[model samples]
Target chain A: MSVHVAPLKTYIYVFLALMFFTVLTVGVAFVNFAHHAPKGIGNVLNDAVAMSIALTKAVLVVAFFMHVKGSTKITPVVIWGTLIFMVILFVFTGADYLTRPMTTFVPVMSQ
Target chain B: MSENSTLAHHFDSYAQQKESASLGMWVFISQEIMFFGGLFLAYTIYRWRFPEAFAYSSNELDIGLGLFNTIVLIGSSLTMALAVRNAALGEKNGTVRNLILTMLLGSVFLVVKGFEYAHKWQHHLIPGPNFQFSGPDPVHAQLFFVLYFSMTGLHALHMIVGLGILAWLTAQAAKGRFTPENHNYVEGVGLYWHFVDIIWIFLFPLLYLFGRHHLT
Candidate 1:
C-alpha cells in the first residue's frame, strides 16, 4: 500500500493553529468570567472555556500531528471506544462525589 | 508476499503490515489514555470538592513557564511529524535532522519542568512532611499539589521515554535503515510522541490555568 505523506504545509498550518489556541487559552484565563455572570456560574464558565480550548488543541494534534485523519478506519474505532470508557469513568465517579452529603464528625472526650 | 525483505511473512503486503502496526500503536495509545484518564478523573473530583484550594494552589505555579513549555511541546510535535514525513519520503538526513530537533525541544521542556519542580521544592510545596501552604485550607491545597506532581511527573516520564525512542530512531535514521515503504517504526514513534503532547495539552490548562481570573 502506498503511504499517504501529508504535505509539509499541513504540519505548519496545524502547528500554527495549536500555538494560537495555546495563547487564546492563556488569555482567556485572565478574564473574569465571574464578573460577567453570577458568582458560581462565572467560575464554571471559566473552567468550561479553558477545557474547551484544550480539547480543541488535543483534537488538532491527534488528527494532524498524529495522522489519525489519514490512518486506517480501525484506528478511529479504537480511539472512540477509549473515549467512551473515559466518559463513563468520569461521569459515574463524578455523580457519586457530587451526590454525597457533606458530613463532619466531632469526637467527644468522656467526662 | 510482496517479496519485500522488511515485510513480515504473516502479512500479505506492505500495506497490511503497516495497517496492523498502526492499529497496534493506537491500541497501546488507547490504554495509555485510560491510564491517564484515571488521574484526570481524580483531579476533576478533587477540584470540584475544593475549588478554592485548588485554585489557590494552582495560582502558586508559574504560568509563564507553563505556557512556554506548552509551546515547546507543540513545537516538538511538529518536528516529530516532519520527521515521520521525511522518513516516509526516504530522506534519511532530513529524518535525522527533524528527529534531533524534536529531541532538543523535548529536552527544553524537561529542563523547564525541572526548574518548576525545584521551585516547588524550595517553596515547601512538595506535599510531604515539610509541605507548607499559607492558604486557608492547607490540607486540601496539599492535595492539589499531590495531583499536580503525580500528573506532571508521569507526563515527564513519558517525555523521557519518547526522547529515548527518538534517539534510537535518529541513530537508525543516520545509518539509512529506513526507507519510504519500511518506516513503520518511525511512524509508531511519531504517534507516541504526539499522544504525549496531547496529554500536556490538557494538563496545562487543568493544572496551571485554574482560576487565574481570581488572581487578576
Candidate 2:
C-alpha cells in the first residue's frame, strides 16, 4: 500500500493553504520594507519575500496536483528528461534575451 | 469473441494499455510545463531588470478576482480528479456527472477571465500604442501585461481544449465505453485538467495578484 494515492478531497485543503499563503505574502509585501531597511534595500527585501512565497506555492502545485511526489523511478526519469530539456531551452533563450541590449527609445532620455 | 481490441493486438492486457496511457499523458503534461516555462523565465528576467515596474504594475490587477479564480480552478481540478476516480472504479454515471461539473467549472473560468481581459482592453490597460500605464517604466509595465496575456490566454486555450475533451469523455462514459478495468483515458484527461489548475495556481498569484500588496 505504498502507492499512497492522493485523494481528491485533500486538494481542497491544499487550495485553501495556498490561498492563505498567497494572501499572507501579498500582505507582508505592503509593510513598507524601506522602514525596516538601511536606505534603499526595502524593495529588494520585499521582492525577495514575495518571490519566496510564490515559489513555495509553485512547488506545492508541482508536488501535489502533478502528483510528482512519491513517484517511481521511471516517472522521475521521464520528469528529469523534461526538466533537462526545458533547462536547455531556457538557457539558450535567456542567452539571447540577456545579450540583446534594451534598444527601445526612452521617452525621458529622448526628451 | 471477446473483441475489446481497442487495445493493440500486440498488447496482452488492459493494464498495459492503461499504463501506457498514463505515461503518454504525463509526457504531454511535461511538454506543456516546458512551454509555460518559457514564459515563466521571461517573467523572471523582466522582473529582475525592472523590479519596480513589475511590482507597481501588479498593483493594478484585481487581486480579489484573481483569488476567486484560483479557488474556482482548484475546485474544478477536484471534480476532474473525481471524474477520473469514478471512471477507474467503473462508475459510468458518476464519471459523466463529474466530467460535466468539471467542464462547467472550466467554462466559468473562461467567463471570468474574459471579463478581466475585456476590462483591461476597454480601459486600454493593454500594452500597445495608446496603452495607459502611468508607471515609471511603461515598457516594463507593458512587458508584464504582455506576459499576462500570453500566459493566461494560452492557459485559457488549454481549458477550452480540456473542456472539449471532457465533453467527448462524457459522451463515451454515457455509452459505457469505460470500465473500472480500462479508464485510463479518463485518468489521462484528468491529469491534463489538474495540470491546467496547477498553472493557474502559479499564475493567479504571479501574473495577477503578485506584488500588489507591496505597493499598497
Candidate 3:
C-alpha cells in the first residue's frame, strides 16, 4: 500500500479551522438564547450549539489529523459502530431518567 | 518476502504491518471513547437534573484559563500532526523538533490545569468534608465540581501519559530510528495525541462555558 503523506498545508488549514471553531464555541456560550426562546428550549439550544461545534472539531481532527479519511475501510466501521453504541447508551439511559417523575428522587440536601 | 529491515516476519509487507498497527490503535481508542462516554453520560444526567446549580458552579470556573488551555492543546495537536508528517518524510530533525514542541505545549496545558486546581483548592471547592460553596444549592453545585474534577483530572492524566510517549518518540526520532517507510509508531502516537485533543475540545465547552450566559 502506498503511503499517503498529506500535504503540510492540509494540517495547517485544519488547525486553523479548529481554532476558529473553538472561538466560535466560546462566543456562542456568552449568548443567552434562553431570553429569546421559550422557557426550557433556550438552554437546550445553547447546549446543542456548543455540542455541534465540538462535534465539528472532533470530525476535523479525526479525519485529517488522524488520517482516518485515507485509512482502510475498517476504520470508519469501527468508529461508527462505537458511536452507535454510544448513542444507544445515551438514549436508553436518558429515556429512563427523563421520563421519571421529578419527586421520585428529591435531593436529600433540599429536604 | 519483505525487504525492509523494519518489516516484521509475521507480516507480508510494510503496508500490511502498518495497517495492522493502525487498526489496533483505533480499537484501543474505541474502548477509550466508551470509558469517557460513561462520564459524559453522568454529566448529562446531572446537568439536566440540576441546571441552575451546574450553571452557577460552571460560572465559577475561569474561562480565561479554560480558553487558553484549549488553544494550547489544539496547538499541540497541530505540532503532533506535523511531527508525524515529518517522520513520514524521513526528516529526522523536523520530526524531533515538532515532537518536542508538542510536548512543550502539552506541559503548558498541565501547568495551567495545576493552577486551576490550586484555585479551586484555595476557594474551598475541592468537594470533600472541607468543601464549601456560597451558592444557593451547594449540594448540587458540589456535584458539578465532582464531575468537573474527575473529567478534567482524567484528561490531565492522559496528557501526562501522552507527554511521556512524546518524550520517547523524540528520543527515537533523534536517533534516526523512523524512516519514510517505517513511521507507523509516530503515526499511531499522533492519533492518540489528536484523540486527547478532541476530548478537550468537548470538555472545554461543557465544563467552562456551560452557564456563562446566565452570569450577570
The candidate scoring highest on DockQ is 3
Task: List TM-scores of chain B, every candidate.
Answer: 0.97, 0.95, 0.97
As a whole number from 0 to 100, the lDDT of residue B154 in candidate 1 is: 99
TM-score of chain A of each: 0.84, 0.62, 0.84
TM-scores of all candidate predictions against the true structure = 0.95, 0.84, 0.95
Candidate 2 residues B129-158, lDDT tens each?
Answer: 767887788766878888889999899999
Winner on lDDT (1 vs 3): 3
Query: lDDT for model 3, on a 0 to 1 scale?
Result: 0.91
TM-score of the first chain of model 2: 0.62
Q: Whose TM-score is higher: candidate 1's or candidate 2's?
A: 1
Per-model DockQ against the true two-chain complex: 0.58, 0.35, 0.66
Residues A56-80, candidate 2, lDDT per residue (tens digit)? 8766765665566754456677778
lDDT of 1: 0.90
- By DockQ thresholds, what CAPRI class is model 3? medium
* Interface Cα root-mean-square deviation for all models: 4.1, 4.2, 2.2
Per-residue CA lDDT of model 1 for B1-216, tens digit only, reads 346488877888778888898899999999999999999998988888788889899999999999999999999999999999999999989999999999999999999999999999999998767888888677778789989999999999999999998999899999998888789999999999999999999999999998788878
